[model samples]
Target: MYTEENTARLLPDVAVHAQPHLVGELDWVGMDGIEVPVRFDAGDGDVQRASARVGAFVNLRRPDKRGIHMSRLYLQVEQALSTQTLSTATLRDLLRGFLDSHKDLSDRACLSIRFEHLVRRPALRSANSGWRSYPVTIEASMIGEELLLEFGTEIVYSSTCPASAALSRQLIQDQFAKDFDAGKAVEHAAVLAWLGSEKGIVATPHAQRSVARLRVRPAEGAAFNLIDLIDVTEQALGTPVQTAVKREDEQAFALANGGNLMFCEDAARRIQKALDADKALSDFHIRVEHQESLHPHDAVAYASKGVEGGYAGKGCA
Candidate 1:
């Protein structure tokens, strides 16, 4: 099955032929959902490897050309992404390499990589910790000499309904008034015993697991530190979901939720304010959704940096 004559034979390439099936330039033509390996620095002195789904595309500018070389794009992605640490500069080079392979047929190139980034999270007030996964997507596009980049991530937290909290407080106040007389001096031990009883706290506020989806455009020449972003987001929200918890940690989490009662609108505004104060991010879009425990429907809110020619908060895309 192997011979010198077979090796010398030419392989047919149909993509090189000029044909006129439909004579119009297409916006983008390439591949999506390509399986690839991505390596990146986690900023903790270790390079993490992630299984990613990659999308590579280049504009089809030549009307008469049958199709661009697709295998070239795949090979380049497999080669560069598997070995190199992912960064803005790396993505810029990869996009430029796409255009270089299709010299005459394409002028603009774009790429998208989606993966789950894992991080170790400690308990609220315990020594225990566990791994948590965050969904992340990085997008890059290059046209001529200019490159545009954006990254999106999702954070899960706990949200307690503010209105429900107020109603519960009112019920507790009414119960306290019924138990103690205003004109009489109440003993401290009796009050503590009543507060510890089940009938004393009549109602509890409703809380639900909520998610915050964010897209950000980093400032030029800034290091793309995802952990920093996550830290800031969790700090602003104040009630990040826990991984491992002891009794004390659970109590601490309850205290945090009690202190940080929020509506979906409140969560969005908090994130917006925090992001605005971060100089590393030039523009950002925030979308928060509270999966309501009381109602079947979810409550949501959206916000964006009000910068001209930036994210308009129109859609999550």
Candidate 2:
């Protein structure tokens, strides 16, 4: 019953997208919080599938256009992500698709995908292992013909205040001097009993949960190495929060914290040094936050590769 003429009359062709606009070229116009399934190559012959929150955008070069085809961006993102394993090459193609769909309306496009990356981490002193979720984000942008990619992640660890540790040690030494006369003969049993008593540890250093947020851009032809970057950061900090821990593991963690006392400055510097040694990352920005147990506010430090037009080393908090 539906002929071509009747169908054309029933649904009229609308040109709302070509409506006149007053503004000039807009910087970015697109959609955010689009839920999509993405596949990632783990670099070890493994592929990880995750549901991610995606943001897609493009620079609207034509001021006369009413708006960009937002649904087109979403559809392109969904199709590409569902079909291909994410990589620099695939991401470039995806962004290119954004421009292709828009054609003469846009020349620059950007995409941001955020998800939690899970890895099984072994206990510090136990045979057990548990999954740890690291919050991660991948950002890709194409300006004209140039494509830029950045990988970011957040790592949580323990930071013991170096100044607080030194002060605690001083107090403990003073307590020990008071408990046992320096010139008197120190008996083994008496020293052991004193060490076991509450008076022995007159003070304790303040340690608190800390976080390191890092964003890095890999060099040309380099792959996005999320796991490697996480490992390097955790190793440098020396006190990543554990998932499964027995008494021995807890003690080992305590020992690690004690040995690697750091202020926010130290934490940032350690990560900076480690990242600098890595050849894969061409530019990076690091922010370390020491949630102070002694103060109401947190202590924070930020560092960035001193490259021209690189990250500005701004603190997120």
Score every model by TM-score: 0.94, 0.94
Model 1, runs deviating above 4 Å: 1-9, 181-185
For residues 1-77, write the lDDT of model 2, one tens digit per residue. Answer: 78987986776445345655455788999999999988886555578898999999999888777678888899999
lDDT by residue (tens digit), candidate 1, 250-315:
999999999999999999999999999999999999989999999999999999998989887466
Candidate 1: which pairs clash?
Answer: none
lDDT of each: 0.92, 0.90
Q: After superposing candidate 2 on the true structure, give the runs of residues whose Cα lies further than 4 Å from its correct spot.
A: 1-21, 312-317
Residue 87's lDDT within candidate 1 is 92
Candidate 1 lDDT score at position 307: 93
Assess candidate 1 and give its TM-score to the true structure.
0.94
Q: What value does the lDDT take at residue 79 in candidate 2?
A: 92
Report, for all candidates in order, the number of backbone clashes. Answer: 0, 0
| lDDT over C-alpha atoms for residue 106 of model 2 | 92
Worst 10 residues of 1 by lDDT: 2-11
For every candidate structure, what is the RMSD over all alpha carbons to the true structure, in angstroms?
A: 2.0, 2.1
